[model samples]
Target chain A: MSLLEVKNLCVSFSAKGKEFAVLDNVELSVEQGSIMGIAGVSGAGKTTLLRTLNLLQRPASGKIAFDGVDIMSVSQEELRVLRRRIGVIFQSYNLFRNKTVARNIAFPVIIEGVNKKKALEKAREIAEELELIHRLGSYPSQLSGGEQQRVSIARALITNPRMILLDEPTSALDPFLTSRILRLVKRVNSVHGVTVIIVTHDMSVIKRVCDQIAYLEKGKMVFCGPTHDYFSEYYLSVSHDDHAAEQLEKAKKILAENGGNKLVRLVFWGEAAGEPILWKCSKGLDVSVNILYGEIEEFKHGPFGTLLVATCGKDSAEFLRRLSGNVYKMEVLT
Target chain B: MISELTRATLESLYMIFASGLLSILLGMPLGIILYTCAGSKRLASVYRVMDVSVNIFRSVPFIILILLLIPVTRRVTGTIIGPNAAIFNLTVAAVPFFGRLTENALNTLPRGVSDSAQAMGVTYRQFVFMVLVPETLPDHILNASVLLINLVTYTAIAGAVGAGGLGQLAINYGYYRFQWNVVLYSVIILVLISQGIQLLGTSLSRMLRK
Candidate 1:
């Protein structure tokens, strides 16, 4: 089940007497245990969308459901409680100048009404995990940017939030620090099953950590799919290449019995999907097959994607003519 | 000569301490007000009123302020010509000067500091008292020291109008009687007093700075 579902979200801002729509009718979802990355250029409304998730900016109109509960329907106190379950880290590492590193981490815990000592202990625990145990007493000015961001991550993690929204958490860091932060985030997701949502202009960040990616352009979601397949040419992949010649001869023989027609591959998901479609197509047509590259992908559910090819003879053409109405070409590997 | 110097030194210290305290107590808040209101687009009208009043007060020289306040001083404290009366006039002049100084110091702060505090869920009041004020403390102290130096000169003028302190002593024995040695000694002591206040202010600000 989806842990968070945002439908048709819209956000706009009026600054200096001009209205700009930052996010327009954007939709997104996160499954129970998946990291989703929202990748966009600056001012593509990635930050605005992340802010809207926690009600930092109320949507002009939309439904945001966290664990199947409508977020906008909750009372102010209840919303605060809900927000506690969704931690947010900022790009600028907004650590309080007057507060020490420890105090900055302890802020959200204190907001949740945890006693000072208990909150400090929890903060210390996370601080140790982030490798900032010794620098807790130092003010923000004394620490490097990477150290400050680590504290910010530690602070977000201390809440044990069900979902964490990271807004360009590594944008200010150098390469070394970026890797360290990415590792920390990966570790957080792997060990704790925390649902992570990151808004980043950095493609490397998207590639390194996200399981699924949603690409936003001009405040609209242009692409939303699994990480590997979204940008890949994967419509044609076939396994069992050793038997490729054998399958091709058999499929060709079957297609020769029928008149010339169209031949198409109806790509289906999972192991159960491709076999039946292929069998049904063969029984219904005289199949002259050109078995291309076919492969099976093991998705979150089960094996998915089947690549096949056929050359329709006369009767197969008639059958192919009927079947061409519904199918997508994965690729022309030949 | 030593005894004479000692007595005059005590009197100078008294004038500095008493008038300095009065100016700061009244002046600091006025300074905060001037800062919060002046040049802030949110409080443009308040800035205008404050601007006009501060200009009027600042335009009047210290000597004239002391002279003008004589009757008002008599009305308030029932005396127009003593060290106490001198303090009243000194505060009147010092507050506007110090307030403007304070406003300028606060204005020089990076706008990001306040904006960042607001984003942290800090209330507007806490932003002012905790972040804004503390961040500007070093500059505020520096300006206050400058005011203290100016007040030393003003205090001597206060002596010309019967507000007796070292200034009265200088004028009566040295300037009036042509005892240039006495005037020279008084001038030397006043310079020392200002120098001491400046050194203290600088060290204290250094300690407070990051």
Candidate 2:
């Protein structure tokens, strides 16, 4: 069973007695010990979806099952245990302004009746792993933005939760700090084998740290798949037209230069994706193929590529027809 | 004359501190309830009642409130005239005033502070004591200072009901007997007390700021 399964979840807010759906018919499943990113533009309900999983924003209707137990039907005591098991980090970092870094991290542990001294020790250990040991005595306001975010991460981890939900963890950080935070998230997943569900508007964040991807749009789950598939498919599905158009323009220019040539765009996934497919396909086509545009992206699973190939004095339709059997997407542009 | 001045000054302090502390203890919770009820979807009716009631009670003149609480004051303290009675009336009047101020202070907290606390899986009770109260503590201190400064004026007015304080001494020796020295000394002492409270409160608020 998946570690967390949200099936057909719906949530609404009633303002002035009119109900507005915030999360509509959202379904998602996250496995144990995997890092998944939920990507969307603002108002897409990504954060709301994460909140629903934690049951913070109680969904109007849905069944969220964690470890085969329906979270919606759990008793209050069981719900508390469920909440403790699923940690959430907000964009603001939310370190209690008055408490020192160690105490802020120690708070949830102490609430569960751990000895304050032992809790602080546990906090220091996590802070050390996150490279925040030196700032343990500092208050939240005293830390820089990046340091504060690490402290927030430590506070979330101190509970030893099975899953952690991060909502725009790097939105307020600089580029260098953003990379550091992403690396920390990756390390936490690899080292601890903990499940992490991150909500972010930044595609770079998803590409950097997430093994799986969930795309939310207008309160709907538009796409969910492995990271490699997302990398190849995301650009095609979205309006990041410049990146796609740049390659297409190069292919077009080559096709124009090589009079009567065709532009064949190929997308490959899994073991089927790599350098050898280009060689074999060209050799099979019996025509000298000029590589117009080429790029390969490495995702969590493996490698994927979107290649724009062209041929002189020949149409590439026959070549593409054959290539379609092996690759995920193949299109002939003339 | 010196002894009399000292006694009036002490009486004023007694009334302000005793009633101020009691008012805070009672009013802060009242303010919390009002805030929680106002924010929660299920507590709309409770919020409406409390909101309107606070507004109404706040609008009542302090002198009228003092007179209105007289019977209960006498019942509680077993005396209708003295510092004890003044304290009782002062406390009852201050509860809604300070409650409103506490509510305002809590309202000034950024929404994210509360949202993050709820996301942390804190129970409602824990959210109040641990997060809500402390998150708004700096503002609460400032608000308390304003309330206390305002209450100093209220206490002097309580002297109208034979509550012994500088106001009574000024009325007896300065106004009725026309002794300008008694009036001037009392006014100067009151000014010092007000300044001391204002300065100490402002600095304390500044020191604890996040």
* Candidate no. 2 TM-score: 0.93
Off by over 4 Å in 2: A15-17, A235-242, A245-250, A253-257, A270-274, A312-328
Q: Supply DockQ values for each candidate.
A: 0.15, 0.59
Query: What TM value does chain B of candidate 2 have?
Result: 0.96
lDDT of 1 by residue, A54-124 (tens): 78777889999999989999986677677778767787776666567898788777755679999999889
Candidate 2 — which pairs collide? none
Candidate 2 lDDT (Cα, whole model)? 0.83
Q: Whole-model lDDT for model 1 versus the true structure?
A: 0.75
Best by lDDT: 2
Compose the digit string of candidate 2's lDDT tens values, residues A84-112.
87778888877788778888988888778
